[model samples]
Target: MTSTILNPYLEGNFAPVPDEVSVGDLPVTGTLPRELNGRYLRVGPNPTGPAATDVNHHWFAAHGMVHGVRLRDGRAEWYRNRFVQGDAPNHSPNTNILAHGGRLLALVEGGRPPVSIAPDLNRMATWDCDGALRGGVTAHPKIDPASGELHSVTYLLRPGSEHLRYVVIDATGKATHTAELPVPGVPLVHDMALTDTRVVVLDLPVTLSMAAAARVASGTPESGGEFPMRWTEEHPSRVGVLPRGGTAEQLRWFDAPRCYVFHVLNAYDNPDGSITMDVCRYDTVFRDEYRGPADVLPALARWTIDPARGTVSEQIMSDHSVEWPRIGPELVGRPHRYGWFGGIGADGLHLSDDVNRVRGGSLEPGPLVKFDTTTGEISTHHFGIGRVTQEPAFVPRPGAEAEDDGWILSVVHDAATDHSELVVLDAADVEADPIARVHLPRRVPFGFHGNWIADNDIGE
Candidate 1:
């Protein structure tokens, strides 16, 4: 199959839309805030057909697709797009889509498990929360804005599996706790960092490449590709911590410096004992190019974990070029000054030489920044020039009180009319312009993480 004409992630704005529409009242331009009712979900990876160009075709292994809208009271209501039905039938739950406790999950980390959608986007099944999850689950789970508990660390790819799993779930959704942590190899533990009392884990140095799983068990082509993972200078890049409900021998690793962190813009518990996180760092990931990801560019570090002098102190705060980071779900696990990101444009931007092959590179992601971690100021909004932006979702305002008082929900993407909008900004004047935009009839390709559930928290 290795020939979708040199693939670049299916072409264009990362193309892959084959129909799943269901529209209604969606077409606003301004005003949409009667305390902004509910639903604004987003989940990416959309490859329901054709994708098998070999080398394991990856844009993070496509096929999840979910793009909601629905606001209320102030209007801008319907607009949907489905396809998340996992548990076989091509299971693809993309990456992230939240709403915990009241259900609505749709994550994807190591492979299959969380899929219970239906706030009108359908697809109801495959949730292991009852069996307390046995296979996979971390699409960035960490919902504990004061014990709404949903934390997760889940990891499983089989083949000698040296351990990883640490769920929590409480706050009425159940799955009280689960532990197992021994690791040394199966790495690629995507994202994790929640603190009120700990659970940080990042084991890094990318792992899992048993010669790409023996070249997909000898069927070789580009040899079972699709991120079988690899970037092991001999492993060991540590940063464990763990101790919220404790176990895994009470963890405490620390070490860190071989860089690679998918996302984690908040984490705290530092009075005098220390433990501050804030990440996006990526000095290396998946290694010197294996068809995709690792051209490098992800800065925004700030790790200071001194488990009694075991050590871990690095700082890079911001030199621009950031990636999906948000705060204010009441600042999950505490302490935050202000944070939001997605900026990355520096010139005509480009990212599809068959989708980031990187030679003559381009991934121009421009504006929507906003960081003032207590006086290092930087605020951006620039949604002009073939625009592209995703991952904002802050939404608070409803009798709010300082700490970035509300609304930032983003979804941009308008490569000169390829379409996709849902803007909204105003999280304390993010350089103004766009207190609302919501027009999305199609073209929402690039995606990975979203949430804004209100409606009194769905469920009923």
Candidate 2:
């Protein structure tokens, strides 16, 4: 008899919650901010009973479950968690959740469209932008702060496919325009970068591999080779800079080394007609083991691309390990002084062999780090041991003057209690004690992305 070894993603804080919960009047540990009248919603993988224990279950295949905390008038009003149901029972958008065009959406990569969720996190349905979205959208779409238009880059899910599109949706939730392009072997374009004048497309080395797919097709509890993508040596890692409304032929390309980027902190246009993109860059990911991301960790690096000279320069900003970087709300595709990242430390480098291990180790967050771009200064706030934090979203205070004048909100999980709480800290001073903490009724499994949706934006 062959033994079934569980995937590391199915254990510890990475595990899923069984029931959909709704609780009212969640207890607050400190005073709540009156200016904050919104909900913080986050989505992640939550597979049901048998799938969670299945040896072939990949972390990316689980269904999407969103956990939300509603706050209004200096009170923690309610807490709710709901699944983002897809067309089929098994398919769900388990990657990222955000508010766009006055609607809440759950998003995933690989050519899947967005799933809509109500404000109360009750129901979910596949949203096709009134039948205008001809194809799937990316998980990380950059919404222009000034114009409120959403920009995205979409790719076909299959390998060796040449289909890629640059989709633009207007402020009213309508598909405005799409620029189609033909490219080499289909790369897993996880995220995109947006500047004022153009959009940055990442055509990286990691592409859908038939070899990897064949291994996954065997359907066994093997030690490795469970994922469906691999790093392709033939596919040259490059950056394609496309003008906002320009077509495929107008794209300017710059070649780069073999690397992968799952997220972009921010990108902006420099004065010299070049682009500056700061990203969490991994040297190489999905090369060998297909279980999760790279066996190595990602470093904070800035890539300066000069289209005129056909050159790309790399600068390592911080050697310390960090992920889930966030800047101010209005700084998307714009230059900003400060950025926040969840400190990963060293424990996040690889998966542990012990599936039963828990209690504040192995990929759990360490501290909330603040990086000053102008001064090269770093500040961090450690939540002590056994307490880990998720992605920190920076919300500017009402009538805020300075760029950093705001609050940082994130879901913090405690290993001892197996519980989670929404912690709010001053963006200007994250090292200080939290200004408010909204204790949740249940545990929030380690999730991917979340955002604070204000009432006025949703027309509440």
lDDT of 1 by residue, 224-321 (tens): 33667878888989889978878888887988877888899989998887888889887886676654554576778888988988899888876776
Best by lDDT: 2
Instruction: Give candidate 1 misplaced runs (Cα > 4 Å).
Output: 1-27, 31-202, 205-208, 213-225, 230-237, 240-261, 267-273, 278-304, 307-325, 328-390, 393-402, 405-407, 412-420, 425-435, 449-460
Candidate 1 residue pairs in clash (backbone atoms < 3 Å): 8-354, 8-355, 56-226, 345-366, 350-362, 351-362
Best by TM-score: 2
lDDT, each prediction: 0.78, 0.81
- Residue 266 of model 1 has an lDDT of 88
The sequence of per-residue lDDT tens digits that candidate 2 reaches over residues 1-460 is 9644366677777889999888999899889899999899899988886677765566676788999999999999999998888666655898898888888888988777888888888767888787655378888999999888999898877656796888889888988888887778888898999999899999999888886666656665552325577778888889999888778898877897568988899999999998989898877777744556635667788899999899989988875667899998698889888989987742332222332232222344557888887887888877766887868999998789999999999988888889999999999998899999899998899878999989876745
- Candidate 1 — what's its lDDT? 0.78
Q: What are the runs in model 2 whose C-alpha is more than 4 Å off?
A: 1-6, 214-225, 346-362
Q: How accurate locally is residue 257 in candidate 1, as Cα lDDT from 0 to 100?
A: 74
Candidate 2 global TM-score: 0.93
